[model samples]
Target chain A: MTDSFSGQEKSNAWSIKRRLTILYVVSAFGILLISTVFLYWVLTTRLAKEDGQFLAAKINLLREILAEAPNNKEVLQEEVEWETAPFRLAKYYARILDSRGRVLIETGKMDTVAPSYIFPRPARLGQTPSHAAMRKSTNGHSLLVMTALARVGDSRGQTRILQLALDISHEDELISDYRSRLLLVLLAGILLSAGVGVFVAGRGLKPIEKITRTVQHISAHQLHRRLGQSDWPLELNELAGAFDGMLDRLEDSFNRLTQFSADLAHELRTPINNLIGETEVALSRERVVEDYREVLESSLEEYSRLSHVIESLLFLARAESSEARIEKKLFDPRKEIEDVIEFYEAMAEERGVTVTYRKASAAAGSGFVNADPTFFRQALSNLISNALRYTRQGGKIEIGVEWGTDGGLNISVADNGMGIEPEHLGRIFDRFYRADSSRSENKPGSGLGLAIVKSIMQLHHGSASVKSEPGKGTKVTLSFPD
Target chain B: MRILIVEDESKAAAYLKKGLSENGFVVDTSSEGDGGLALMEKNEYALVILDVMLPGRDGWDILSEIRRRGIATPVLFLTAKDSVQDRVKGLDLGADDYLVKPFAFSELLARVRTVLRRGPVRQPDILNIADLEIDLLRHRAARQGTKLDLTPKEFSLLALLARRCGEVVSRALIADQVWGMNFDSDTNVVDVAVRRLRRKVDDPFEKKLIQTVRGVGYMIEND
Candidate 1:
């Protein structure tokens, strides 16, 4: 358990559960300690006051009895009888002295063990009663002593010093017992709070544990599974949402990768099958010299097809992986577009399609852009070729260059021919996606034209977009950053 | 037999023309889909060999267009796309057969024969005239009950002429059917092959069954 706890600490210094439990226990302990101390103090002060009151009350009763006496002798007799009374079960001692320090009256209880030093000496008249020091009697009983000045006889000018002592051993025992019991209750309360802290902390962190379990069950193949966000706490809900968002992106990329492989397999299979079928059939029969020559020529065609596919695939791979380098240079956009148009003019004329170039009036002034001329021209060439392929005889294809509203360059190719449907426009830039498979079947295209164009724009930190209406026309735009 | 080849690739089209011509069929070639479609609409053909990828129009569109016009011409799809879906689509679009590109001349010729044999204008099982008998199914040719040892091309050449015994088949037609060549190459390949074929089929027999109409073509006739 220690090993596991240390490992967990390495990951997160203290887990939430442990931290919460510690916080709860520490706070509870602090509050419990303060209250226990307060209660103990109140109890001790009240007990001490009660003990002092009891001693004072006893002294007042003795003074009253002395005042009612007719003479000093009777007072002495009364004091002696009071000390020996059956109601006075507690240990007690008392004495009365005249102004000259001569003992006037004394309790018989003091004859065996009297604490003379505990009585105040030379007490001032009319002084408030004061507690004297504690003393032990001969029987080893602890006592509290008090002293006061009083008038014991009927004479107004006469004063006496009164000293009293009471046994307090039993009260001390009760207070000690209460103190020990209070301390035990305080300790038990702290321990119970710690136990409660752990339980509350565990309940509070249950959502995190649930999230961890759900996350643990997710693997690459099960990326589609999402963490439950509904029943979680607010903070944990946000975490689950973020995690689910990440999975969404992961699953999207995974699906794209799978689709790419399937498309690649299909694209590669055609040429391979052609090569196999052709060679197998050729070798099946013994043919004349001219027939053998024809077979080799056909085989070379299939080989070229294979090489073309590989080259295109390699270029795509490099571009997608960011391994393809772009050498940007300041050049005239108009000249580049014209050069591309010139290159495709022959093929366009062969198809009886007219190609034209247009420039916005503002673009003619400063139409230069910093870009890789070769790749830029290639991107334009792909668009032009696509337009030419879709355009019909006598159809007009226009290439236009202009300054975009965002201070960038926008080069567009528009053709008045068969336009793409809106549904296909979104995926037109995806690799191996063709707008119309039936129409593209006859065209000599690898179906990577738009994808390559998109990649080129990406390498140049630009974007490509298309707008078209079926049977009307199609326009493709390439935007470059300023 | 007269066949139409609609292929966008010039070289492949030339090869197909040569191979079909040398096999004793008259072959017409078009490098674009629209041109092939126009040609097919103007004339009747025994078979139409179409490349799926074309410039102006595609093979599927052309096939559908012809089929829509109630033209029951058998179409054979010749393409570089050999995917099962592509093949299935071609067949679904009323194509009689499908052959991928970079194909052997012999295989194309055989498929062309198979298509032609199944055509509406069927030929007899055995073409017989002037004691010369050609077995179309067995690919065998014999004169007067004596078996003839002939190469495949030679036998095809004999069978072609014997089928049209009294008609003049042009050199262009023979070249297109036998060698699958679209344009005449400046060589005596066809003449040389024919001379060798005549040596085995005619030179061995008393009466000559092969004769050349000067500047026109060759024919087998009982004179």
Candidate 2:
């Protein structure tokens, strides 16, 4: 519908500018025609009525003079001749017709009589005058003729009709002049509207063209390119701002992913080298049975390390690429937390770290919420591992699960250990980033525990935050939205 | 003989230690560039295996440093970077050879031996085990002084086995030494080559020197 109305295709024939211009021209021309027709009808009818009255009065005067001098034909002719100049100056043609409708007295150079004209009978005797008005031509000239009957001096038997006409050539020329002026005004309006329409169309399309140019210049390698804020409208500024923010996130994420892959390969190279190198060395040596056993045992340990690294790296890869499918199900938060803490009790016992778990009574309407059990367990395990690694030999670790006032569940893992510094807290979840580089050797980690934990929490649509000081204990909290 | 290993990782260092120690070469390692240059300047090493990336500097820098210091130690780069540009760059920087990581240790050992063979040791190019003899210089093989007709691949396989007598040479090592690049061939090229060489070198003999250890590769040993 819009396309048909706008004539979208044929710009040369009906552009938006031309269409708007045409509308203005057509409406103005129609209005001018109606007004000119109404004005011309009103003015021409009034002038004709007035001319008819003046002619009627003149006819009455000539009748009175003719009645006073009953047989004076030459004097009547002289009186009529004196009136002829005034009538002619007023563009009127007067002629006297006898009672039989024959032309008796003719004025000016009209030598032959014109054809008779007709009119409908009037309703009243004198209120609506019964007259015949028509266009007639005699010889080479044309004239309008109006005829009215008049009684000679109260004698109904003797009636005379006077015919009058006023030439309309000057009125026709005046109407033509008015029409030409109306056409000029209509043309001016059309041209002005057309120019305005083109200007508006250009202004409206400018921002759209800028968006196109910005998008065209972007590529995979150049994801950093963003639509910068410039001289744009309000909505366009907001759109460009949102686009730049999204690009900032994408570039940061892609760079981190690439760096992580490289680091994974670099980290795994060490273990694979140990496995292959150890096996080759043992097989190449001419050793006794006992020596062979020793070589086999050590090689098995190296293989296990390789397998462990590969498993952890695979988990990290799945998390990084978002390939890990999360199955959300309703599970009791209290039971899940207690079970996890109990499972880690044996490992904690070895280091004399007492692990205690406490679950607060489920809050109102908070018996359970939706969560991925596997990811939840994985995230909890990482927190436990970190707590145990940093805790003192006889320190206590608290694992508590509770329902928050808001529609969420909070699980906190707090331990009495050397807490992290404010500076390191932000980067603790980075791949291969350890709180203390020296502690890495002691704990013997792949350095992907916190990174994997962060990813798992993200998958579960939850968040993990940590609070720590230089010397006090640390608290790690996981919040799952209800 | 002296051998140099330029590896960035410590675990790989330990792995190479046991293998090269048993191969009769006193192996020394550098985990970075400065250490590797320091070791090369202080010692007269026969072979050097370097990695591309290190802490202080990279292997290419060590290679250039070694050359700048006029140390003509044969360096074989062992790294995970396997692009052509890396190879060309390493060779251009005075590296003797390049081997990508995730490599079979025996292949590494073989390259080390090959590089060392052309070094100062310059041992006799002829290898003899029991009655079987391989003349590396002439590229010929025979059993009990009887010259045998061997194909180009068979002669090389027989020669490699004869050189590493009494020790198990892995199939991956054999493939690497022969094919150069690590390509998986479906056919049992090693076994077929060994079988064909047995016909040429042991068929007309009274004693069989080419013996196969059940699950292991073929061995040329003394009776």
The lDDT values for all models are: 0.75, 0.68
DockQ, cand. 1: 0.01
lDDT of candidate 1 over B1-223, digit per residue (tens) = 8999888788887877887787788999998878887898899998999888887678889989989889889999987764556888999999999986645454466577767767388568998877888899999888999989987777877887887676666554565565443222211345666777888988988898888754345777866
> How do the residues A34-57 of candidate 2 rate in per-residue lDDT, one tens digit apiece?
776677678767756765566556
User: Against the true structure, whose TM-score is highest?
Assistant: 2
| Candidate 1: tens digits of C-alpha lDDT, residues A350-387 | 67898999877764547777788878877887788788
Q: Rate residue B136 of model 2 by lDDT.
A: 87
Clashing pairs in 2: none
Show model 1 residue runs off by greater than 4 Å.
A1-201, A218-224, A227-229, A236-239, A328-332, A360-370, A401-408, A439-443, B1-223
User: How much is the lDDT of residue A95 in candidate 1?
Assistant: 75
